[model samples]
Target: MANHDQVLDASGLNCPLPILRAKKALSAMESGKILRIIATDPGSVKDFDSFAKQTGNPLLESGEEGGKFFFLIQKA
Candidate 1:
């Protein structure tokens, strides 16, 4: 796994909150940095995928473990 520049724990946040919080966090990070988002919402799988596509930020990795979703996004 690539080292994350920051981790955004969006656990328990549903729908757009995780994506919103990730956007905010990404804004604060330098270009080319990686942001790790940990969330519980199953919708986040699609949400993050769309967010990455719409924003042109590459979704480096995504998966689920122990009922939680994890996304690694590389800032554009």
Candidate 2:
């Protein structure tokens, strides 16, 4: 896993919530910094993918482990 500047654990949260939190977290981050998001919602995979595309933030890496989904989003 890549070293992240910050982490937002959105575990147990559903769609929109995780994405919303991620957006907010990224807002406070500096450009080129990485924010690691941990979410349980399976929908987050798609959501984050779209988010990275729309926001121009690169999705550095994404995968699942121990039943939880993880995303590394870098601020644009």
**Highest TM-score: which candidate?**
2
Candidate 1 residues 8-66, lDDT tens each? 99999988899999999999989999999999999999999999999999999999878
Question: What's each prediction's clash count?
Answer: 0, 0
Over 4 Å off in model 1, which ranges?
Answer: none
**Native-vs-model 1 lDDT?**
0.94
Question: Residue 5 CA error for candidate 2 (Å)?
Answer: 0.6
Kindly report which residue pairs in candidate 2 clash with one another. none
Writing each residue's lDDT as its tens digit, candidate 2 over 39-61 gives 99988999999999999999999
Quick one: best lDDT, which candidate? 2
